[model samples]
Target: MADGVPMVATLAAKTMEVPGVHTLSLALDTHSPFDFDYGQFNMLYLFGAGEVAISIMGWHQGLLQHTIRAVGRVTRPLVALEVGQQLGLRGPFGRGWPLAQLRGRDLVFITAGLGCAPVVAAIHHAVANRDQYGRIVILQGVKHHADLLWQTQYRRWQALGECQVLLAASEEHRHRHHWRLGLVTELLALAEFDADHCAVMMCGPEIMMLAALKQLARLKVADEAVYMSLERNFQCGRGLCGHCQLGPYFVCKDGPVFHYPQVKPWLGREGV
Candidate 1:
């Protein structure tokens, strides 16, 4: 089921430094503009080094922006690419933000470290469909004040009055800039909202999500109300590759977004 399309996209523009990460915007030739929800991810292919999943930060004029953190070989070149460069890509794949289903519910979104990418899409989607939901709370954890991404856009989202955001740093000693220091979970304990009325969403480091999930259980949040994404090495663009399989589930097809119960049992299992 791997999507072996072997297609390529043109780099439309590249930005130097985007708040918390580096960004590259690409314009791909397609028959139609693909549809995607906020929390979904696309499988990005690099011919030599292989593939990685990245979220669409924003899109316009047939372009999709991916704000990436330089971590491995494939992404290292991604950060160095100039305008007019060609890049291999295939998909607007994986599950996205639960926009429609979240209607009428107050929402809480939490993220830490590199997890901000996928969550941003959900935030953008919700703000666009503000009439469907109630209050929104955004909680973030980072290493330092400078580590927070998209300050300008984030400030604009905050201005909508539908969202309240915070940044928690792991370090104790701090900066003059306004933000909390510690963990994203700490913000949860301070909030007195009812879990029954809110849907919980998160994107971040494995440990961060693990800690966040543990805390949510204490909050009495229902299993169905909690959600997180999955990531794995994919050899084929389509589901046929089997490299990204988790038992019967294919991260490429079944999900990159799974309800807690679906993946909780496979946490330490091989092929997960």
Candidate 2:
């Protein structure tokens, strides 16, 4: 893959796990080789349909892996794509969770299901440079045990920081757990969150992040210290398209990740 062309490969791998859901792991090579900030997303093109925003969950060699759960038109084709199917890709875009800037301060992460991908990236960067940050914690929630991706990686990350998680459905297995068993927000009640200099990040549905924001405020954390990954259409990774627009900001440009205080006024309204 040349640095000037998109790798645009066929579906490198796909699988249906007992999470009972069909998930696809795509490996794409891009001409513009780039390093992605933890939580940045890329625009993926599925011929004959449209495009979808996907986060890079893992990357190795020249291949960047995206773990996708089949949901809509773009994703459906992605799920149906065979090992040799081709597709278009651009980005590694969006402002990622800014844990790097908050280095030396306490940090907390709350995510749900696939939302954990970005959170994992932040953790990967943070832990690798642990001396630059303070205490770290993670709380992840998914529909079921199987919906949880990267268990081994999570375990590895857990070894580096204070990690915890929740699973809505626990019917399939049993393990000695430090894992909580409810909504991700519930963990807020148990944490002694430091609002003074600590940063809290939440990524999931808007409602989930909103709830986390409210609780962080109650703990005296300023809105500036609270961040979220807004889930929007994100049709254009370059920010020219308006699908993920929010007033003066473009989620693709301004952020998929933003501090709550920076975006509070624009949440419910429309028109960018």
Candidate 3:
């Protein structure tokens, strides 16, 4: 658990979809149990290939799950590894979503593009403790219907009467009945929830999140009640690198998850 020490994690199982997007279910050594709150991420190293930080998709039993999109050097090679291959893992690092504060409040999750990955763990947490909260709403947006991930998982969550899943794709699709066509924020306008008693958690590109924040403000959701996952160029997950700095805070150390008010000053600030 030292700053640079990487623990060996064996690949237990995998679910492959497209070439670059897949889920790797990993098993860490039992003696060195890896436990992390939902929304936290781990630094994954593929031996000599290199390492990259990815959010934990979900966790169950003794396995830790990550949904990886092979976009960069470290990740492109990672998705090709076979099931029994071993890789180095160095975390559970960074701050996570505040699930405790969401108890008894209507919960809304707004995810766009790959932003859905980080919120998957939080969705599982909400589903497992359904009775503890009011209504649960999830709005997902992608460029095309083909970009949707975890459709079956979202269906399971929707089976529960307290939860609802709404998806919006920017482009037209044959499956029109299932999802609306527009920005995800358009669907947000139709959602009926208690604005005063709801907590909103959003993840997406900076532009999408900034636009969503504006819509949330129109709904009267307090800045403190809204949370977001901010991604930056994080080299060292421990915050020593200064690569992921955002104004006065370090994105890797102080957050990947932060309440809106805590980060308002730096959101879209020039050259922070």
Candidate 4:
């Protein structure tokens, strides 16, 4: 697909219970394949409502899926979309998780809330090549139990012997079973990955990532071995638009995924 061309894709399925969040399965209206690496996002447009960037969740069979939460003018209409509707897609853009470099090493994924959507593909990739990694650990956090997005899928991931999944919620809910009630960083405290041998990939609110980094620091994880997906205001997927600029980089072109050290200098700084 070209950079700016809008490919019309049909909404093949929908899954949701919350008022504003949606998990949509979209298939190319032309019946073509939508291939993308884990961590990349697509620009989705709804005819009159404009577009928004959405992370590529996992694909089921041949349909591409995205977990979208209504947060803006464009997304509000997007979440309200029904099956059989058509929308415009312009990506599979940006860099992805360093899955290739992570082979044979322990893998740790730390995500909060909707952040799980971006890493779902990476989890599947690890499972498909299960022997390539030492141990696979996933730590997820949400505000409340009702905020959890793929409840059953976590079990499927845990079924893989090499993988371990732990969940936490900042605000406790009554239905809690095995879920720990506290900050996500609390799970990090109990995690047992060798900092030197593991590659850590984290995403979520900037604060959550910062908190996780602090905990990882106590564990002695090297700055180079840690990575994060940075979210910025990206207008154009290419570097042309300065909306996604961060210091000397354009998040859309240079990142979305970056090594922790590369962004450390600007972490808490105001207005890069």
RMSD of each: 2.6, 3.3, 1.4, 1.5
Residue-by-residue lDDT tens digits, candidate 2, 3-60: 2234476566666643433445555553655577888887778778888788776565
2 or 4, greater by TM-score: 4
Using all chains and alpha carbons, the TM-scores for the candidates as numbered come to 0.89, 0.84, 0.96, 0.95
User: Which pairs of residues have clashing backbones in candidate 4?
Assistant: none
Q: Which stretches of candidate 3 lie over 4 Å from their true place?
A: 174-178
Best by lDDT: 3
Who is ahead in TM-score, 1 or 3? 3
**Cα TM-score of candidate 1:** 0.89
Between the candidate structures 1 and 2, which one is better when assessed by lDDT? 1
Full ranking by lDDT: 3, 4, 1, 2
Q: Candidate 3 at 257: error in angstroms? A: 0.1
Model 4, position 115: C-alpha lDDT score: 84
TM-score order of candidates, top first: 3, 4, 1, 2
Worst lDDT 10-window in candidate 2:
165-174
lDDT of 3 by residue, 100-158 (tens): 97899999999998898899889888888988888999999988887888877767776
Q: How many residue pairs clash in all the candidates, one count each?
A: 11, 5, 0, 0
- Clash pairs detected, candidate 3: none
